[model samples]
Target: MIDPSENPELWDFLSSLHSGELLTGTIAAIEPFGVFVALDDGPDHPLFPGVGFITYPELSWTPFNEASEVLHVGQRVSCEFLQFDTWNGEARLSLRATRPDPFQLFADGIEVGQELQGRVTEILTFGVIVEVADGIEGLIHVSELAGTPCQGTQGVVRPGAYITVVVTGLDRQRRTVSLSQKRTSKGSP
Candidate 1:
């Protein structure tokens, strides 16, 4: 079989035709709606001026008001091709598609007895959600927070605090990561 990498142009064109293709290009223009890119320094033409997508500004609220603020001309970005309009032949893409997901990260990096530092994201009656890294979140059950029989998660830990925790166990089959903040701390519960 011929090597696909031998011809970059043939690869991009064929790859674009396939669903779930990841395309990377430099942003050529940014309007209120979306940002456009120039694929492999390709010519600016109506048929294909690279791939573009209009993202809701709320997706990245703090730094962006419109697409222009989020992406400037000549910015590099990677996106997944979501779908192709069979009739109009326009390609749809999403930036969020690049994220692998929290549970996957947890499964990859965690081991029993390993210590990790994370920010508390959510506190619930059952437990608190601690975010360790981008897309990696784990649950610290109320029972695991302290030795005492805690009534609520707040009594054990507060949100937005950077807390050190330990991985007690992992249910790989269920994709759940069990952690304990009390075990990691110096003092006893």
Candidate 2:
């Protein structure tokens, strides 16, 4: 029997793949959490049909309701190689990393105390996450949710509701934007 480990071609192919390299592939499978890609003109994965893989968050810069909304089986894609997931024995790929980050753009154009309108995407005990722009969401802490103290986010806002908020803080490096729903006399600059 031929020993698969002894194949020089397999070693050469695996050796050629490096993190941060761009690779072209076809979607071999789609799961709730990620997508499996069959690399074009590349050696097959020892365990999977393709070597490239993209997690849910890495699938797109824009928020998606489902994996099918962004990718379908056999769809061609170009993705950035993040790393080789040793545990899963697959290449960790990112489709969003290949696209422009909307948060970066929003941060560059706005500043603290600026009033912006956004849609509430999620309501948590501590805060409400609002989508201020495409692919850009900001957190409105419980303290900032309203003028008066509230027991929880449910008292302040609901998902899909539109609200006006003031930019309270920002962390460009971390991609975090803090917003306040409390009404303020000061106007946005």
Candidate 3:
């Protein structure tokens, strides 16, 4: 049996966790290797002498330009514990691997006709990806951006711009969110 007092730091860390612990930590450092977090302090401390770690596979699909962009020193973060891995002393952490993603908050709350304010994150030939809320990205297609028959999505909206839009549909399975700015200008869709 593992004695908790022998390794107080590790014990304290384990004490702060549960089966599916969701907590926030700050980025203490980011190396090409992985991200390190100052685990002791945050909105929720998951460990006593708080520390965080991120490996290669965990950074996938994080929308970070570089590993550094994924996190920065002193940057706060949110993640869930996959469960304690005593076999290897590896407590797998996931910042983007939560089930029933928190993003669904916006999806679940939005109605087809409800108006919303969204910030453009990326522009594609077919549509613009707007982040209506943190982790919640909705798309405004070329046709839905404007009713004037614009050239493309770029013609109607630009990245970093905020626009008023309407939720057209919610695809929970595919996680595809549909929005329309033109619907509001044209008086409802």
Q: Judged by lDDT, which candidate is best?
A: 2
Can you rank all candidates by lDDT, best first? 2, 3, 1
Q: Candidate 3 clashing pairs?
A: 39-50, 39-51, 40-50
Query: lDDT scores for all predictions?
Result: 0.63, 0.79, 0.66
Summarize candidate 2's per-residue lDDT along 1-189 as a digit string, tens digits: 223465445455555778889999899999776889998867777666677789999987777899999889999999998875555556789998888888888889998989899899998878889988877899988877673574666656778988888889989899899988884443211
User: Worst ten-residue run, lDDT, model 2?
Assistant: 1-10
Can you give the lDDT of residue 133 in candidate 3?
78
Q: Candidate 1 — which pairs collide?
A: 102-135
Q: Candidate 2 at 94: error in angstroms?
A: 1.5
Candidate 3 lDDT at 90 equals 36
Q: For model 3, what is the alpha-carbon lDDT of residue 117?
A: 83
- All candidates: TM-score: 0.54, 0.79, 0.53
The TM-score, computed over Cα atoms with residue i paired to residue i, of candidate 2 is 0.79
lDDT of 2 at 9: 55
Q: Best candidate per TM-score, number?
A: 2
Instruction: List the candidate 2 regions with Cα displacement exceeding 4 Å.
Output: 1-7, 85-89, 150-160, 186-189
| lDDT value, residue 99 of candidate 1 | 59
Show model 3 residue runs off by greater than 4 Å.
1-30, 36-53, 56-80, 83-89, 95-102, 185-189
